[model samples]
Target: MFHIKRAYEAYIDGFQEITMIIPKSNKHTVHSYFELIYEDNRKTKLPIVTRIEFERFIKYTVFTPEDLSLENKYEIEDEFGVRTDLQVGGVIRSNDFDEKYAYDGEDLGASYSNHSTQFKLWAPTASKVKLRIYQSHGDEEKFTEKLMERDGKGTWKVIIDQNCDGLVYNYLVCVNLIWREAVDPYAKAVTLNGKNGVVIDLSKGSHVSKVNSPLQSKYTDCIIYEASIRDFTSHPLSGVHKKGSFEGFHEKGTTYNELSTGLDYLCQLGVTHIELLPFFDFEGIEENNPFQSYNWGYNPLNFNAPEGSYSLKPEEPMTRITELKKLISVYHEHGLRIIMDVVYNHVYELQTSNFEKIVPGYYFRQDERGLPSNGTGVGNDFASERLMARRFILQSLKYWTEEYDIDGFRFDLMGILDTDTMNQIVTELTILKPEMIIFGEGWDLNTSLSPSSRKATINQSHQLSKIGFFNDKFRDGIKGSTFSVQEIGFIQGKLNHDYLSDLLLGSVGINNQVSLFQEPYQSINYVESHDNHTMWDRLKLSNGKDSEELLKKRHILGTSIALFSFGVPFIHSGQEFFRTKEGIENSYNSGDTVNSIDWARAERESSYINIVKEFIAIRKRFNCLRFSLKEEIVRHIKSVKVHQNIIGYRISGIEEIDRVKEIMVLFHNGLKDTTIDLGNEDNWEYVWDGTKHYVEKGIKAECNKLPIPLLSTVVLVKY
Candidate 1:
């Protein structure tokens, strides 16, 4: 009969008000009288402030001199004794509410001890809270229900005298007078399919030793190779027993036709870090029949728990943790670090998400009309600016870094988040691991967050200098637009020397031009990643009339630019062998058929793969390519006045950071051969001429002129 539109503290100090709507169907003659019933049944009469008649309902405002606690639910009664539960409306999204109920205690989730376990849940607006403990995660009936006492900052707490290890639990929160069950938002471990939270003994596999990763002096020195645990080993020819699982991903001695296929292949390929797609607990796959469906794990269901489908024993909570740890350990031992692709920009769905269930309106952003913001395109942008929301993200990242020994985090749709959150993430994660790599998709998206300048998009990259952004400019400038296959890039003969030169110089400002980054490492140079079509596939579409031989070289040219650019180089899992997705663009749920990494392609494209390896070696060998500061890049790197079809640069101070005195790079973007002027003294040598690479095997060129291979990247090193 009545809807409580708002019951919040007015901006004027020491004043409180309530707004309610009474439908015309409730033909009560006297609708002005009302009383606010507190939780203890104490009734306080409210004075009528204003009323406005509408077509179908009458809007009424009641004023109270006293400020009531929003944490304690109240009820409102009309003159006819029709009572309605006081519901949270626009107030929960206000700054006053966030400051009052923001919980800072680290014990928001179940904290286990040898003899006792304490559980805490942040449900400030709930009328009642109950803890449901189940013997098993999937049990329909709970073993027992216990009432929890309200703690400081609107959190509910309860202590169990016995150990809670292996026990499954969830909270039943009574909000808006309706009981709803939800998993703990801070759950570190979950049962199969993330149905319930598990009290995990974190010390079970804590004995895993530190991995012997390679020495990377700077973040730009990292050669990132992105892969998914499922796709990396899902191919039928992948020589491993545990297909598409954590154990299989790191399985040693895996090969096809006596060639390395899985982890071994990555090791030999010279990549420093392996960026895995979200391996955290996500939706879209049945844990019981994991092989029946496929997902890239972007739909985050649990922040701290590993994905169940990737574990061999999904039913065992500890199995996932230990197995994933072992996987990281294996890579670390092989001199490769790991970076997790985290999707904190949004949840899989807002309505069914634990954040909405616990604190309905606190976790996500809302538009002026009070609807969920869809900046993420999947509904609901995470409210990282909120204190409690930021706390949750910070804690989750720390847990992964400390517990799983995670080296870095790659944020998904980072633009939807606030700048403060991204800065804090980089600062804290760097403390835990100084050699950490942090970057994300900083695409400027339309979101409800005010002051567009505060978004962590590339537009605000100067504010977030420590974090890197995926260089869309590099992708589009070198390989064409990722979204369109018909558009050709500089490598495909759509040469724009000045534009391509900016990208080759790491997209940082040069020659008074506004650039994308303040520092060189802030640009993540790559043409292919997990999100778009492979470089081979795109070149095939854009240059449809070109031959396969020329297409392969064009693909190599783009990869070459990305690797040798003045930024962190990134490579997709199957980019080397002309890997195609059969024209599929968004393969988030494309199953194993189109997404799996075909090992056979490795054998066919071994030659191209070797060239990429040499490019990596050159990048690692030269410090000029991995300049940490903007001043170093601006001073050392100079654009060469080469032909219009070629992109060229000279690093003069190479003797300072490397054994070589200087180096010159030429990217020929035309279809015809050309001559590049070399010194007549015969002091330069061919470090890479498309056919061979490496300084030790460099051939001396005793001439003043050098022939540039068409659609090829050439490097000349001075000794």
Candidate 2:
């Protein structure tokens, strides 16, 4: 049994340090022989010593006694000077040992041919740390165990020789006469529902190198499609063997491969990018499920490793990696980019987390009362201001980009990170991959924080000029039809329409001026994204009716306006097919029932799909529709006519001298059909009308007045 000789907190430069002592023993003793093992499978024997003194500061540490107490029992002294017992008595083992810090002069960190592995844990408060290696095949067998040696710092490391790669292991750490087992914070791999760590073959698969990727070309034209892996595949129409798995996306005959959901769908829809939801290792918290109590994958467990549930065969470690490469290749071949929606804001609150176990105070912010900050409302918020924490985030980004050939990243909650960190990341990422795209949810949840608390604060507004933001104002104005009084006057066909003109020219209203017009693609315009209510749901709320025909008309009008607006237009998945979430606004926690895109609706709602397809074609055909440059290319004829229920505007543009471009747009928001005058034009021609009428040259006589159906918009081109 280990006993603490002396225990007291010593403050150094606004940090606390904990020291511990353990008595040396003869047999099964603390000071006996031991070795250290690292990821490269290099080992070094521990030097025999009488006593070990472990000293560490709070900032850079990665281990906590509370996490280690899973196997061993321990005690903590409160502010009142009362000691409380903490439980411990499990096993702890390391999967990777940093050989560079070992006393042995060999570069053991670079070796990985043998089964031997090394583990390193930071336990500043532990009196002693021990390595427990269990027999691989035996039910209950004991093997050679050793007490970890402490260095100048409080790092505890041990090297052990194992029979094979799939052996179970744990760490036995002692704190205040209580011993417990703790899982390694840095374990690269773990067994499914098992206590021991599994050895992962990092080099077994073909790693995609960043140099070979063509991501540079497609990064600039990203139109991300955020989707869940399971929902995309589990649908009955998906038709793939590896359903709901990584391989399912690459499987032939699948919805994703049939050009129905993957590259084919994106290419046909003319979107340039696909941004997937969180794909990292996450816990599927069942209680939050909408249908059968399932998690939405927000509880991230590991940053570097992929989720096991998404893999077709978790034991075959390379399956997910290999399949992911195929998916990327398919998208790249079709001239489309892939972006990942990353969550570096906070991690799942697990006992074995790096934030909870090692350097807890350094990884997260603390309140005035010295409590963990919960800005994210998910138990804790990551302190991205910390250097080590920042490095970890950067490393994860680099690994995904360099290994998976991802074109860009869509940060989930970017405001959680400080401005300096974001700027540094942008600088480094741009230098590494010049065309890499970066954007995020710029709003910070914490209102109490300085500079970022205010809505569209001066500092935050300036940040938008540097990086792209989700243009919510533009979405609301176009979809909701509720803009400032100035905008209303313009849309109402009023004279001297400068305010409406500014909005029509792509102003998000936050800046009080037209900044987006300077670079149109910077404003990602959308009627609905994953966060907001679907366009149909919003319309239902406003209209208080569920008439399918009226909804279809509204959808057509919304799409036409969005595509014609001067910004990069984004359509949510299944919007073309008139997909609806049954009026559920916030379905982030909903299961497959609420989140799945109904492909059957596509066949039934063919008319809506056709309208969307036509609008997409029109947007692609005319560059001026989506043009952002501050140039008055289009000329307004200044001719307006108002019938009983219809309003019309006659606009024209000049291509060159002798070539005149003209179009007459009419909006009929009534129930009955009505005719409107086009202000005395002899050469006017009917080009497109929503009433299933397609116009051609010399088909109709010249008429200034045209009849339009109720609740429909008409566009007529004139020569």
Candidate 3:
């Protein structure tokens, strides 16, 4: 019923003999000679043509090369005398160009010198490329355009021997005679909202804080606190000098209700690393007045550049970079590490995105119908398996670690990425910093890539040995399903307490046939994260009839289990004080009021905060809480059959214990108090009890029977 209106393609196989392919659908329609027109107004007639079958709907007619030499303008006339501009479509595949014309240039983006600046772009198929440089901002009248030369490696390069420092620039790439402007993908600095790439000497950003991140030997040793920069100080009571900026994180002595806020508050809480939500240059927030807009920064605009919206001076790109460095520096000075939340799985826009604008259909994955793939639940999943895409990701990670000195990375929707790319990242990053923590949401998403191809899910966790996954099993097991509020977890009267034993052993063991991780370090155990409802809200929704006392008990019980687990423990910011999003489940764009931490509640509920602090101290004080190897876990840690609702475990063979030769961690989830029978009841001593309103010293046990109050986690030690 349909016929090809017009088709044009050029075959380039060393240029010795070039052919133009005009594919027609419904070949049953007439026939005629194909004409070729050159830029010099010369016409070449192709009297002879060969027909070939190309696709189901298309029939290709090939025309011999007309000996046209380096011509930019070309038009192909079909049998119906309809002339169309020739484009390089089926003439080449994205991967073919990637493999054949891979850019071997040592420097990417804008590499600068005192007298000259070289700009490079990897657009192998671009017919013609030009570099447009502006004299200054708000001055469109004065600018210069320079023609670029293409190398065999497919890189387009233009050198400006004059000083182009502080000048804004963009690339003008032509495809099928259609020109498109694109921001540099390798740009280290960009204008507000990524309008253009700025030519600034990166070396000028030399002034940096001397502070270093807190040292961590292993991933399990970290107690991570997840936070959003905007939400941290956007609260009206935050009292920070700079509200909703990287500078706000450095604000000292800022407090509410006589309690410390910002970095000072985190110090008091004693978390080793602060995993910040994405701060990379992302779309959505207007840079000029960023406080008016709030985002979690998952919509990545520029992977390597720091977000301008988070900087005090959004106009200056270096400030965004320098300010973020200073913020990390301040955290480092206070013995804290910063973990960057990276979103490389998908981009916000398709056509408008630089990945598309520069290389068209090359950067993204295509489905069976050749449409953009949406595995991340975001519109387009990045084709990380592609050569250039993988290279970009690897380079971006290195930039963040080396430039900003980030101690860790939290990849969002990491399962959308292929295992090969993830393993390569681990291999390279491990060499750079072996101690650097790398973890992410390894959720299995149905992507264009089949299950066996790319998924970095928990089932495939063995492949990525060094990387870790956010233990959704631990998350759901401890605080119920994040999806439904009515669904209760282990702490909230969910009967099957047997699964808690699996989690207590870090969700993996030699005996555990149904383990989620190959090693304990691969599991990032947590009850609440930035993605879903807070533990308080989940408990509130699930247990509506439960009193405030029971709700608080449930909250503490969840934290206790996660903290005691043999994995890298993670907590959402303000989770210690029963943080509530006012029942808003997904607060990604719910504005400041909906997402800001309630410091007043923190002060009122200081006891619960004290409970979290005490747990952190205990985890730090005892080597038993953090087992180094899987063999040690199996040999030393074992589950005890205390009760159906009680999850109990014992710690032995720990040489670092000064007072306790045997340690027992027991959790009582039942509505009534439960009695635990310690095998060595006579020698057992009650070292710590969660039922106490405040943290206190060890109290001597009665020795016959250990009575644990309902909804409380108790610890006992025997010397």
Tens-digit lDDT string for candidate 2 (567-659): 566677777766677887778777677777666666566566666666666555543454443343233333234664444445466444214
All candidates' lDDT scores? 0.84, 0.54, 0.79
Arranged by TM-score with the best first, the candidates are 1, 3, 2
Native-to-model Cα distance after best TM-score fit, residue 690 in candidate 2, in Å: 4.2
Which of the two candidates, 1 or 3, achieves a greater TM-score against the reference?
1
Worst lDDT run of 10 residues, candidate 1, spans 6-15
Q: In lDDT terms, how accurate is model 3?
A: 0.79
Backbone Cα, N, C clashes tallied per candidate: 0, 39, 0
List runs of model 1 lying over 4 Å from the truth. Answer: 1-15, 28-34, 39-58, 71-73, 79-82, 679-681, 692-698
Please state the error at residue 505 of candidate 1 in Å: 1.1
Question: Who is ahead in TM-score, 2 or 3?
Answer: 3
lDDT of candidate 1 over 1-719, digit per residue (tens): 12334332121112276777777766563466678887899998876687788787777778765776766667888767777777666566778877888987878899999788899998887878999999777886747899999988989999999977898998998876567899988887899999999988888878766676776878888889999999999899989789989999999898999789898899899999999999999999999789998889889899989999999999899999999999999889999999999999999999899999887788999888779999889988999999889989999999999888888889999999999989998888889888889999999888888899889999999999899999998898888888766677888888766667777787887755678898888999989887877887788778879999889889888888998888889999888777888878788888898999988888878888888888888887777777777788788888876788888798887775787777888888778887866555567887887554444656875446788878888888887
Model 3 earns a TM-score of 0.91
Q: What does the lDDT read for residue 29 in candidate 2?
A: 22
